[model samples]
Target: MTNAADARQTKPDWSAVRLHVVTGKGGTGKTTVAGALALALAAGGERPGARRVLLVEVEGRQGLAQLFEAAPLPYEERRVAVTPDGGEVWALAIDAEQALLEYLDMFYKLGPAARVLRRFGAIDFATTIAPGIRDVLLTGKTCEVVRRRAESGQGPGHGHDRVFDYDAVVMDAPPTGRITRFLNVNSEVSGLARVGPIRNQADAVMRVLTSAQTAVHFVTLLEEMPVQETLDGFADLRAAGLPAGGVIVNQARPIVLPEDRLKKAAQPGGLDQAELEAGLAPVGLADPEVVTALAALAAEHAQRVLLEAEQREALAATEAPMYELPLLGDGVDRVGLDLLARELRRQGAA
Candidate 1:
């Protein structure tokens, strides 16, 4: 068995982090990354070292369920997937309306009157006239989950079922464009409630948000706009005093050709067709049309490689730990998620 020194050396980069908030430009695979992170965190351990983590989706898109190929999830947490180490990854899709009802019940004992409020357009009124309350309710519920303790008095990673304890919580948050405002709920609701439960809840959420226990990671592709947005999002996090996590570059394509050929094909005038035809001569596939097609493909690959290198340089300025996930040839599935989780573990993102 490994000793204590090896265990300490193997600790993850985010070992102190309990709340992981993932956001990205749309199509950057934010939800996918969040799910993979949960899997990575929960597994990667032997019997007594296993962990249980919760993956929450707050956008009401039910996209988390779709990512896992499960049916639509209610507001309640349920076991969506079990990790290789027998740990659990529970999922919850938080709905604004349901969260509002729960908030009412928690503070005011609304009982059946909560539904009455919903029936008479109170939900709409709160959402429209006092939109900030919506944010307060949603974030408050998430904080509640993050702070919950186990009923059995067993902390996480103890080889027993943790009824309410989770080692970490991963949220698939909004797109980068709105993530700042979405997370800074205290400012959003300051005018709505200065000293009431709403303000208190908002304050509590912010406390967790600005603490070392929380980290907001940005997912991005190696494209211009996504990379720029990732940079901007990191700046926003710094301004908000929220903890920023890693920059996870997703759907990264590999550079297949050798350096010499890649440089030759990356020229502005495109590839040398006659030279490419000779390269294909051994296969009896050196026709002019085939040569032209091959040259075009090579040119595209070269351009992509060169652009990706430029973006990588841009991402370097962020100074955050970087993690890259490969583009799955067959698209993302359970197996794809497993592969990504392994990569995350190998990269110390777990």
Candidate 2:
């Protein structure tokens, strides 16, 4: 909290949330954030023991599997990583065609017909011509898991003791540009089906989506374009009556120099070559070109810091609970993911 980007609010209380939908700009690392979030939620409960969280990929990119350094995931739920406290982070890449098939089997018992359609390329044609069908299928599958209950059914009488299949579900949803349409697809379907099974399914998904138990968090970088998209995405969520969750700033460069020093170095002609050479002289050797190079590097860092500060200010105006993730020097691997998960826990995002 000492140096967080937004200080207007405290960390969100995620205890009530069961579905965490993460989306962002194309290059904002939304998938990586979703992966880390699954780990944090699984490991950071109040009385955590054997907690299982589902990390679902709707884009079919197997981004989660790659982040965990595993083979490409199937449509089935596969346990990918074990949390520090022995909890599990299971992953599943939700394929649209497969989801459609499952939907037919679950509610309509049309497995045979669906398979036949797939073989005839009807499923592909339908999904392509009506993309909303694909999104509906994917979101439906996600909600199914969010609402799944434990088979034991031996919890408290008031439902406080009831166990759930997963502690939470984190989705690597589509980019912000298309998230509104993707999430709101069910409502569109309602227009076509008034009171049939499809209508019921759409209504059910909407109920879960617009409820307090679901929150859509946005991932962004401290830059102009991504920040603008984040703002627009939040506005869309509000207009569509969707719940807005936290604002996670990913890969934010650390603020090395203090405020006054950074401002001084950022000013025009503030960095002097002679002064840089004098500072570098203490090292074994220093040359004029080296001084020039060092001065340019310091100037660039200073300017970047100043611009990033401006972007942070813009985001702070949203008044959303914010969290920052540092840029991994070695890139996001299994080790890097563990580091990020620990950071989320320390920041109370879990």
The best candidate in terms of TM-score: 2
* Candidate whose lDDT is highest: 1
The C-alpha local distance difference test score for the whole of candidate 1 amounts to 0.84
TM per candidate comes to 0.91, 0.92
Error of 1 at 87 (Å): 1.8
Off by over 4 Å in 1: 1-11, 46-49, 153-164
- Which lDDT tens digits does candidate 1 get at residues 198-255? 8888999999888888989999999999999999999988898778898898998877
What C-alpha lDDT do the candidate models reach, one value each?
A: 0.84, 0.83
For residues 20-121, what per-residue lDDT tens digits would candidate 2 score against the true structure?
999999999999999999988888566555678899999878788888989999988888998778778888899989988888888889978889989999
Cα lDDT for residue 328, model 1?
95
Which pairs in model 1 have colliding backbones?
none
